[model samples]
Target: MGNKSSSQPPMKWPQMPWTDRLLLSLVTRLRDVTCHHNGTVNRRLFPFLDHCTAANPNPVEGVCTSDITIDSSCNLYVRVFMPSDPSIQGRPIPVIVYFHGGGFSFFSSSSPPYDALCRRISREICAVVVSVDYRLAPEHKYPAAYDDGINVLRFLDSDRLGSIETVTDLQLDFGNCFLAGDSAGGNIVHHVARRWAASTRDWKKVQLAGAILLQPFFGGEERTESDIRLDGAPIISMERADWAWKSFLPEGANRNHEAAHVFDSIKAGIEEAFPPALVVVGGFDPLHDWQLRYYEALKEKGKEVRLVEYPDAIHAFYLFPKHNDNTKLMEEMKGFVQANRSI
Candidate 1:
């Protein structure tokens, strides 16, 4: 959290509509009162917001979950969600290595929004969903989260997770693995898939079936029309997005770095080496243009891609379990995984 100085000008930006101004003002006041500045953000700043970390009863029926350490060296952990559906009762099931989003500086696998979302996805998709709690940035920095992602996949491809009794109960078919996430997590999904596709070391023994990116987080040196048009969009504003990039990237790195701008990696011509992808973008979100551009780029590269757009939705809407659009989003993801299972 940044310092809120009493002598500073009004926090509200110019040209903000009255309603938006009211909301942003309230949120800013809350942050000013509850959050404190440190070298890196400690998201547990607000007592009211601590619910995101507290233990909660599972919100989805017929699904079981457990937390396990993925890499002891880095203290990286993942929450494994498994379904009790009769169809996959005694057989190996598809695996989804899911990453949660908080602009790479907030949120965790145990957060309520992610807990409910992953649980629902496990039941709907009938697959083992490993929700990763990768290291956050302004501390761990760029490649740290990426390395944690690769390590989690490698753990899945091996028999290490099965050492836990609960995980052993649900057979995970690594051969049918898929990677997924929303926002920053979606960006990590892209990087993880690309690295695996381009690697020669064969670090992961299982085949990557596909990737599902829900409103992927992306930025560049130049602004797209949507970025300009939706400068102060709800949930993610241009300033907030810029802060995320600055906080997560290496100190001297610019937005054009391959890590910040995914198109650079795509243009490197790894299309034939990549797996099929499903991209979901919200129509009202600021990142909409970049999401669409990436989708078109994938199609132009001749890679199999499926894009689902919600023109009226807000960014990260699917993270809310009670949101009417969330179920539909989860269904679309399940269908995509099943449709591409043979790949």
Candidate 2:
């Protein structure tokens, strides 16, 4: 260790199992041929890859789930997870608005992994979870996903939840609502929170209390130390990251665009009203430097932001239950929510 005060731990790259490797490789190839080349998702193959989960109106693990449309025209919706735990039934609980990570070009709120993750969050934290099924890129492209992310909040703010007995009766604490996401979803969380902050409104409900960004996908044209060292990262290799940016960012735009490089070049995005944040970073993630830059940039602007560094963990480590870091992450998130509960 460099110093007793340093939070940094020993560096260790996670060993990828052959099964995970095979799945990742297959998914990447499918996105290239079906989504990119064909200008639309392969109707037959993409669903197989997504392995989408359906909402169960009845309780599962003491949590009830249902799907609600945010925008039917664009196929935008949210899978709502409400804890049916008897003790917490009639009381207000923190609400977490979640965005899933797939480089912004893949995955959905209903993706099996995300469904499980959101359910765990709802049941463990005893909070309502709304996983946004934002439109994918290379088809919808830049700003489309961002717009959809914000729209979810707008939908919630409209008090539509009050109309649905399942959601309305849950008594979600709108004042304690939080934004949380990983990878590209993390990127969406940041942008959506910023947009919410910049708005001037006194809506009946829906106040952004805090944000949790896990390995937020942000980059620039210039390479950093982590970028060079983890070029061949286990899952989120630099090549895959580059491809993601190409698909999400506007055509002809480089990684230096404001959306891709939030911490630098355009410091204006960090608004004073932006909610307190907890940003998680993995040592083995190539985006490590970028995530750190975001934390520092927030500090420089006098914003409330905390950084959690898992030196031995790899990118997207929070998704898997086996990773020790994932358990730690959930603990940190729970503490953050309890501490940041807006009085």
Candidate 3:
């Protein structure tokens, strides 16, 4: 196990303002009531609430859907959001491959929260957004998701896969690519980045501009004090996370294996060859120190890295539209992607 400090303070969810509290209460009630009879809460509830909270009505236009198969049997469904105006100034628009967060066991690209966020990013950043629907776990195991991710990128870069398409009917330059994801999705991005760097095939030459990790889980074999303190934290608890990880891995597989835990596989090739990355974490999140450690690792390798910590936020806080912090985070993300587009 990695270093564990019992002296660290217990983690807590950030306090919400009255308005936000009321809104959250309403959402909780709706979710509870729906799940009471339905047996499961629909993941779309949160995104639907987000859409309602936003003053703008679907600012994104001309969204398209497609599927790219990673293997002969398994197919990955992808949802793409293109800028309303596809007329680029003869330059290739940057592309963001977004992976949805669901502990790698739940959710899909069709989920409302992912769909809305992808659309918003595509419009706001003036870039192409590709929301990947990789295979889920327990049914599929560790490295399965990672393999699917790498294959998706390969498919996009290959003409044989026929996965590439113009955004908003305008020519797209595949040269600029960004990888972004939340939770388990973040884990996928990290592993994919490492694999891409180590791959020897010509297909591995695709240029990656940057990567964005939102509350990523990077710890392997050890739990930080924050994880212990937030053992029963709302939404995502340490117990829940452990279960998710176990289910996502093959039966009897070691959790500490490099293929299972991204941080364990740290090597010179990964540290030096990875593109600049931005890691966003909530101060109250159990994974706070985990993300910080990842940032430190990147910096030690002399790679351009940025870390943004929201002092008064929680895991998945960015998905809530009613929170002002969410908007601020989005703005920062937009700026980062725009500034790094040329890289």
List TM-scores for all candidates, in order: 0.85, 0.89, 0.80
The digit string of per-residue lDDT tens for model 3 on 252-333 reads 7655766545554554446456777899988777778778888887777677889998887777776666766877777878
Let me know the TM-score candidate 3 reaches against the reference structure. Answer: 0.80
- Report backbone clashes per prediction: 0, 0, 0
Q: Residue 223's C-alpha lDDT in candidate 1?
A: 82
When 2 and 3 are scored with TM-score, the better candidate is: 2
For model 2, the stretches where C-alpha displacement exceeds 4 angstroms are 1-12, 15-43
* Each prediction's whole-model lDDT (CA): 0.77, 0.81, 0.69
lDDT per residue, candidate 1, 69-112, as tens digits? 87788889888887766667678778899998878877689876
The residue-by-residue lDDT of candidate 2 on 57-94, one tens digit each, is 88888778888888899999989988887887667788
Q: What lDDT, from 0 to 1, does candidate 3 have?
A: 0.69
Model 3, runs deviating above 4 Å: 1-12, 17-72, 86-90, 160-163, 166-168, 267-271
Clashing pairs in 2: none
Best by lDDT: 2
